[model samples]
Target chain A: MISRRIGAAAAVTALLFASACGGGYDAAGSANATTKVSVTTFGCEIWNTWAISKGVYVKHRLDVELVRSGGGSAAVAAVLSGAADFGYVNGYTAINAYNTGFPIQMVSGANVNALPPAKPAQGVFVGKDSPITSPADLAGKKIAVNEINGINQIVTASWLKANGVEPESVSFVALPFAEQIPAVLSGRVDAAQLGYSLLGNNNDGVRSLADPFASSNKVYIATYVAAKSFVAKGDAAKRFHEAMTETAQQLNDPANKDESFRLLSECQKVPAETLAAQPQNAIEAAVDLAALDRMAQQMVDLKMMQKKPDLEPFVTDFARS
Target chain B: MSDHGAKRSSLAASAQAMGRGVQSLWLLAALLVVWEIAARLAGSLFVPPVSQIFVAFVDTWLSGSPSSLFLSDQFRVDVLPSLARLGLGYGAAAAIGISAGILIGVWRPAGAFFNPLIRLGMSVPVTALLPIAIVLFGITSGMNVFLIALGCLWPILINTYDGVRGLDRTVVTAARSMRLTRRRYFLQVLLPGASPAIFVGMRISIGIALVLMVISELYAATAGLGFYIVSQQRLFRFPELWAAIVLLALLGILFNAIFAVVERVLLRWHRNVRPEGAEGH
Candidate 1:
């Protein structure tokens, strides 16, 4: 009986071995093929969400299925595991996955950080009476990020470095956005990096500290990514990119401003009034090489990666166009 | 002739023990070998080789000073915090569980009052109360402790209650006939009688406590095994991530082994009264 069980186990192992050695499966090869896009209900993913709600992909002769994956890391996982044809994820997440030998390639930009005069989407906040008046004061203090090794942390690290503060000096506590304000309020954390959506949630005791993304000249907040193998399949990537560009154009049109925010608020499950009141992000469809390179360099600086790879290869031509 | 017979049995027993050890470990060893071979052959970045994981584990957690007993700085920062929370939470649970259990067992009215509540507490997944815990305790270790203690309370309490309630009636009658004081009755008769069941509950709760510790630490934690795992996963350091997971498993085993030793020591008298494989009285 044991020998028979061993035989079955060996057979299973052999099958796994065979499958492992097989070539990558070609996906989205047919024109007008249904493409599964993993999206998160975040402000950055507004473009992709808008595209889906407005049937922009269908208009561009592409069938798109929007799979609501939670968070950037999950979206990256969805795309990498072939569970989705493409994913809208944090730009840093895509680059990090690529550096770690994943087959991910940036297909198009999702959202960009607003330049100075316009507030960035995210910022560090502290209690009104906090001793930490500026980024320099963050040294030797505990601060909260939504996730460690996430975009929040990376941006905070960048911002800290820009302000002559060593990122390592400040201890980073990982808390979900909902719990961050309470942590800060309760003196459990010295400060917290929070999005503008939660700004209304803060009471009179809260104060905005600094804009982390403001350190970068042009930061692509998020990007749509796909596996290199999937991107290589015919003109499916091109069609998807075209659809995203059209989506951006339509959203950017003044006539569609109210309608865009409504779609975004619906997609994100946030109050439409709150969404409209928030600062607008730069709507970018084409991936900017300089901005992408800057993010890769930041990852390298943060020691998240050994060295930045030549990102030219990981970006689709359609994304650049 | 008797001495010779004892020696022969001892030798046979040692041989049997060795055989059992090999039987238990062979599957694990085989699986490791298969995983190593399959991982190398597959060459997937996600599924790293076992050897790589071991190396990463040592590099990440074991590169420590001789003064710190070879435990890395990372261990103090990550693992020690988790252990502290687990200890506080588990310790609180055990103390409360045993006391409350005894109260419920000794006083039928109290038991009746708390019966439904205990059942409700046990049935609900403590993780579902994470938001409420965070609200009450903020993102501090208090939140983690509260969740862990709550999760571990039920098993220990239920088992102790069962142990106390199921005490032999003759023993209680004998204690009463001896004109024992209330304190003496509890110490000499009730405590020992119900200890076996109490230990059973505690043994079950150690696992529960460890689970709650990890779950609670997964969010709003600066330094913990869960935090380390999440950070490594986010960094896409698969080997390091696997190392943290393996460390967690080792920690669980270590806790179980420690529990076994304590259980053996505490229940030694009980074991002497009732030999292995003997029918229950």
Candidate 2:
């Protein structure tokens, strides 16, 4: 009788295992599914949060969940690890992810530095009392970036090269945006790459040393990414892309300025007046393929990767112009 | 006849030791095998097989020449800086702990004053003090060292105090009757009596120091095992990240083993403890 019971138990376990493997159910395939997106508090990710607050996702009949990742690398990890269906990551982070065999593709562009006549969205800053007058002085000094070998690091390197300094001469220290200013002020780092919102309205203790992104009129700052598997499975990517594109368009329209800043104020926790005073970077829903290709080459030149991985396959149709 | 018997007994002892070693290590070997099999079957990128991890570890950390102990440039860049900070931090903790412990243990007033404070300090998590440390020390190696020292300090101090307090009353009386100088009493009587407990504290502190070292290096660090691990993880190099993690585990084991040897040598005269190579009771 005991033997019969054990046999029955084993058969039941096999049946359960078979059932677990048989389903092709995906979150994107379900109606009224919540799309979880990983994002950071600053830069391009703020838009994702703003869209949620503005009810743009709801307009597209999508339920969006924004997960606050620490940084671009973390956001990429979240997407890759299935913690989120999509992540907003720095362009270089997405490129590095692709180069290293992570099956992630760009779903949409998040932000790019504005074409000059408008100040770039990011710049390297030094303490007000620092002796570093130019990019040339930064050759041997440590510079803080949100993530070392991230987009800021690459832009800094390219900017350094433009200034006749070898990118290898300077060291990149990884610090959070919150700590970067303090690091600069205390001389822990000689300079730091400060983003738009992080620069704040009253930047008293620090001075802008150089616009690192000024070297390229169209440096892709950040991109929205989804796992290749997720993009392939259903229309969730389609809906998300349309919603984000609409949000971007609305954010860019001068008529929507008051509404955009108000939503952004809620997302960033900064006053709407303060946000209005800050120069905004261009927000594009279409992935900048030419810019990413250039960045891939730059990664190769900087020896960050063995060779530039073809970025074409990684940019999905929804992200295309 | 006696010599022949001695030889036979020695052979049996060696065989027994071999068996014990195998018995102790078999579980680890079995676990590794199981992990390898499970990982291969799963075919997940996150959990690569053990063999791949081993290869990655060697390539990432042991690809240098024989003269340098087969240590790679990456080891010098990452591991050595971490070891420096750890050594400084642990050394500071040991010095401060033993000295302060002696004072607190011997002086009733001081002990009473510090007891509650030490309890409170020990209860507070070290990671929570990270922001304060950063504010006080900036994001330099100084901050890392300060955190490590703080984390390691409590255990060593408490253990040393216990060791001092636990010393035999007879020994204290004897030292007093001999009229030894305060310095002489501390050196000859109090320290030796309290050493075993002090060693216990130091041993516990070593692990804390290592954990703090990793935690500190995770932020604003240009080079260190923690930084290397985070970078590799970000780059999606799972094997390399796993290799760094394995190296950290090995470092932990190596530190404990070194501490064990030191304790054995130092505490050899204390009969209460079991000595290595001692025959059956």
Which number leads on DockQ? 1
Off by over 4 Å in 1: A1-27, A32-44, A129-131, A185-188, A201-205, A268-273, B1-13, B275-281
| Candidate 2 chain A weakest lDDT stretch, 10 residues | A35-44
Give DockQ for candidates 1 onward, in order.
0.49, 0.44
lDDT of each residue in B34-64, candidate 1, tens digit only: 9999999988778799999999999888999
B54-74, model 2: which lDDT tens digit per residue?
Answer: 999999999999999999999
Give a tens-digit lDDT track for model 2, residues A24-73: 32356455544444333344355665687778887766666666777776
lDDT of 1 by residue, A1-321 (tens): 999999999999998976664332224646444444433344436676677778887676565666777677777778768888778777898888888888888988868888888766677999989887999999988888888888888988999998999999988888778778878888988998867767666757788887788886777777888878878766677777888889888888889888887877776788777888887777888998888899999988988889988998889877994
Q: Identify the CAPRI category of the predicted complex in candidate 2.
A: acceptable
What local lDDT score does residue B254 receive in model 2, on the 0 to 100 scale?
98
User: What RMSD does each model have against the real structure?
Assistant: 7.9, 6.0
Model 2 chain A, TM-score vs. native: 0.85
Please list the residue runs of candidate 2 whose C-alpha ends up more than 4 Å from where it truly belongs after superposition. Answer: A1-26, A30-46, B1-11, B178-184, B272-281
TM-scores of the candidates are 0.89, 0.89
lDDT for model 2, please: 0.83
